[model samples]
Target: MTQGRSIRLFLVDGTPNGLLTAEIMNWTGHVLTGPRSKLSELVQRPECGRTGIYFLVGPDPDNSLRPLVYIGESDDVGTRLKQHNRPEDKGGKDFWEKVCLVTSKDQNLTKAHVKYLESLLIQNAGQVGRCKLINGTAHEYINLPESDRADMAFFMEQIRTVLPVLGLDFLRESFGNKAKAEPSDDAGVDSPRLYMQITKQGIQASAQEYEGEFIVMQGSTTRVDWVAQPGGYGALFAQLCEEGVLSEPEGKVRRFTKDFAFSSPSAAGAIVAGYNVNGRTTWKVDGSGITYGEWQDRQVSAAAAAAAAPE
Candidate 1:
C-alpha cells in the first residue's frame, strides 16, 4: 500500500458477473496492480465481500494526492471501464480528459448510497468539466440485483478517495474563486462617466473625443446600434445640449433655441435636415458635398498611401 498516492479505477459492467480492476500510481510515477475481484465473488463470499474498499497508489505526474476518477457501483465494472477507454467515444481521451467511474453490481441499490455517490461525483466533477453519471438501468444487458446496500456503500467510498489525487479538488477551488470575482450589475452602473446612450432609431450616438477627432467611448452602449460616426454625432448633439444651444426632449427631436446661431454652415444644414439625418450629406464643408461614407473611404485611402510611402 502506497501512502498519499493516486489511483485510477475502471469498473466493467456485465450481467450476473463483473470485474473490478484498479490501476494504482505512486508518488514516484510507478504503477502497481491490485488483486482483481469479481462482482459475484464480492457479494457471495463474506470475508472477501467485506473488503468493500480497495486502494492502489501510484506516482501522480501533476504531484496531486487524489484519484483522477471514481466509480460507485455497476453490474459490469469491466464493461463500463471499456466504454471509458474506447476511442470512439468522446469520453475516451487520456491525460487531457481525466475521468473515473464508481459502480456496483447490485441493481437494488439504496437511495442513501446513490445520493452519497452523487455528492462525491459533484465535488470531484466540478473540477473536471467532463464528469458524468450514467444510469445502469439504461443498459438492458447489465441487470443489477435489487436491494444491494453493502455494495453501494463500498462503491461510494472508493470514489471519494480517488478524487483529490486526480486534481479535481484543485479545479473545484479555482472555479469557486473565479465565480466570486466575476463582475456584477452594480459595478457597471457605478461608473456613469464611462457610459453612453444609443437611440432606438439607430442614428444618434455618444462618444469621447481625442486630439480634434472623436474617440469611441470604452464600454459605451451606444455602439450596440449606431456606427462609430453616428455615435460621434450623437455625442456632439449631447454636447450641444450641455452648452445650452439645443434642448433634447426625452422622446422628441433636439430643439435649438430660437435665438441660437450656428458657427458653421454645415451645422445649420444638418439642423435643416429631418430627424435621424445623415449629417455628412446634409452638411457641407466648403462648396463641396460629401457623405460620411465617402469621408470614411477617403480616410482609409490616406492611411494606405501613408503606409505605402518610403521612409
Candidate 2:
C-alpha cells in the first residue's frame, strides 16, 4: 500500500474558488492556481516572478468531456501571464479561463529548466488524450544536466499528484495504465467485472467501475452508428465517434479504441446497447437474469442486516 501524503492548500481570499496555493509536505515545489480574472492578483505574489512551467486550462467548446489546455514556460511567468491576459490581437491567448503554475519555493528554476518542464508536460498531456491541447507546435527538446533532469522528473511526478486534487485533470495519464490482473481482450482469464447486453442484436460489452467512472473496456462490442432513437444517447454516440473513442475496424461493427467513461452506468449502457435503455436493468451476470440494481440493493440490505446482528 502507498503511504499517506499530506498537502496544505491556502486560499488567498478565503474563497474556495479564488486564488489558491498548494504544497506537498517536504516538497520544494509550490503550485498556484486561480481564475483568469484573478491574474493580476496572482502576478502580485512573490513566486509569480520566478521561472516556472504553467498550464492554461479551460473548456473545449466542441466537446464537454475534453478540456482545452495550453502548456507553456517562461523566465518570468508573471509577465507572460500578463501578456496572455491582453486581447488576442495583442498576443493574448483567449481560450483559457484558468491558470495553474508550478514554481520552486526556493526560486531555483532557470530558463532552460522551465523549457524542459514545459516540453515534458506537453508530451504527457497529449499521450493522456483527456484534453485538447492548443499548443501551436510541440516543443520537443531541452538540454539539461543528467542529474538535473532526474530531479526535474521527480518534481513532475509530485506536480501530477497535486493537479487533479485541484480539479485540473488535463495532465492525468490514460486509464489503460490502471487496469491490472485483467487484460482487455475477451479470451483472457480475467473478463470484465460487469456485462451489459443487447442480446437481440448481438450487441454486448464488458465494463468495470474505475475511479468513479463507468468505463466500458477495450474490445467491447458496440454499434458503428447511432442506431438508437433520437435523443441523448444518439448525441453521445455521435460525440464518441467524433472523439475517436469508438471506431469501426471491419466496418459497421465498432470496437472501443480506448476505454471510455460515462457519467453513469446507464449512459455507458446506452452507448454500448445503441438504445436509450436502463443500465441497472440491462447489465447482469451472464446467466443470473438479475439486474444490477437488484443485486446492489440485495447486497446493501444484507450488509445492513449483518451489521445489525449483535456481535
Candidate 3:
C-alpha cells in the first residue's frame, strides 16, 4: 500500500505553465519546474545556486508519444542551467523544453551526494523506458559513507515522490512483475474499474484505468511484429521495443515485460491486437457484456444524476 503525501506547490508567476516550486512536508528537498523561456528568472532563485541534480525535459520530435530527457548534476545548478541555455550551435541542449531541479532547502547536500543521485536516476530512468534519454552515457556513481548513502537514499525517495506531481514520469521502473503505477488520487480512485480485451489471435489481456491512461498488465502477449508500419500505434509500438518495454521471452510473440501505459484503451488494444481497432468497443468488463464505451457512459450518467440530485 502507498501512503499519502503532503506537498505544497507555488506558482511563482501565478500562471499554470510558468515557473513553479514544490515542497514535501517535513522534508529538506526543494523542487523547481518551469519552462525554458524562464531560465534566467529560475536561476536567479536562491536554491538554484546549490548542489543538485536537474532534468531537461521535452517532447521527442521522432516519438511524439514519449518525452525526451537529459539528466545532469552540478555544484552550482544555476550556472549549469545558464550553460544549457546557450544556443544549439554552441553545444546547448536544444531538445529541452522544460527544466526541473532537485536541491536541499538546508543546503546540506554535497558533491558526492548528488553524483550518486544523478547516476541512479540515469540508470533507473532508462530502465523505466518512459522518456527518450538524450544523455549519451550513464555517470558512474561516486562512493558515499554508509550514513551518507542512507541520507542520499532518503533524499532520492523525496525526489521520486514529488516528480510525478510536476508532470514528470521518468521513474516508473518495471522489470519482472511489470511496472505498475500506484493508483494515483486524481485517476478517479473514487471508482474501481477494469476492462478486458480478447483478440482474435487468442490474446487475452486485462487492464485497469490508471490516472488518465489504460495500463495493460504484464504477461499480455502482443504480436511479435506490427502488421502495419505507418501510423501512430505502429510508431509507438516500435518505440516501446526500442525502449525495452516489450520483450520476447518465448516464441516470436512479444509480451509486455511490464505493465505498459497507453494514452487510451484503444491504443492499448491496437498495440496488443496487432492492428487498428476501436478500444472503447474492443474492451469489455468481465462477467458483464458491457463494453468500455458503455461503462464510461454509465459513469458519466451516474455523475450527472448525483450532480442533479437535490441536497
Candidate 4:
C-alpha cells in the first residue's frame, strides 16, 4: 500500500506565474523554481546560496512532448545561476526557459552530497528517456560514506515525489509496474487491459491506462509504412522508429519492441493504425467488447452522480 504525503507550495510573489517554493512535511530538502525570466529574483532567495542540484529545462526543438534538460550541482547555486544567465557566447545556455533547484533546509548538504545526487539524477533521467539530456557524462562519486549514500537515496526519493507535482516529469520512469505514480482511485482496482486492431492490415495491439498515460504494450503490431502526412503523430512515429522502439518488419507488420507510453490513446492509435484514429471509439475492453469511449463515459457519469448525492 502507498502512503499519502503532504506538500506545501508557496508563490513568492503571490502570482501564479512568478517564483515558487515547495517543501514536503518531514523532509529536509527544499525546492525553488521559476521561469528563466525570473532568474534575477530566484538568485536573491537565501536557498540559492546553499549547495544544491539544479535543472535547466526547455522544449525540444524537434519533439514538443519531450523536453531538453541539463542537470548540474554547485556549492553556491546563486553564483552558478548568474553565470548560466549570461549570453550563450559568454558560456551560458540559450535553450533553457525555466530553472528548478533543490537544496536542504537544514543547511547540511555539502559539495560531495550534491555531486552524488546530481550523478544519480542524471543516470535516472537517461534510463527514463523522457527528455533529451544536454549534460556531458555524469561524474563518479564513490568516495562518499555508505551511510551518507543511503541518506542521499532517501533524499532523492523525496525529490521524485515533489517534482511531478510541479509539472516536471522528466525523472518519472516509464515502466508501469515499477512506476511510482499514484494507484487508481477506485481502491487500488487496476484498469482493464484494452485491445485495438485493424483487421484488414492484421494489426493487433493491447494497452492499459495507468495514471493518465496510455501505454501500448510490447509485441503489439503496427504497419510497416505510415500512410498519413507527417504531423505531430507522424513526427512521434518517426521518433519511435529512430529510437528503435519498433522492431524491423517480419512481413507487412512491425512490432513494438517494448512498452511505450503515449500522452493519449488517440496518439497511440495513430501510430498503431499508421494514420489518424479516434482511439476512444476504436479500442475495446477485452471480453466485454465495450468501446473505450463508452467505458470512460460510464466512469465519468458515475463520478458525477456520486458527487451530486446528498451527504
Local accuracy by lDDT, each model:
0.35, 0.81, 0.80, 0.88
> Which candidate leads the pack in lDDT?
4
The candidate with the higher lDDT, 1 or 4, is 4
RMSD of each: 22.3, 3.7, 4.9, 3.2
Superior candidate under lDDT, 2 versus 4: 4
lDDT of 4 at 73: 96
Q: Score residue 120 of candidate 3 by CA lDDT.
A: 82
Estimated TM-score per prediction?
Answer: 0.23, 0.85, 0.76, 0.88
Q: Which one is best on TM-score?
A: 4
- How many residue pairs clash per model? 40, 0, 2, 0
Alpha-carbon error at 80 in model 2, in Å? 0.2
On lDDT, who's better, 1 or 3?
3
Q: Is candidate 1 or candidate 2 better by TM-score?
A: 2
Q: For model 1, where is the 10-residue window of minimal lDDT? A: 188-197
Q: Residue by residue across 74-159, what tens digits does model 4's lDDT show?
A: 99999999998889999998999999999999999999999999999998888878899999677789889999999999999888
Residue-wise C-alpha lDDT for candidate 2, range 135-172, written one tens digit per residue = 85577665799988988888888998999989987776
TM-score of 1: 0.23
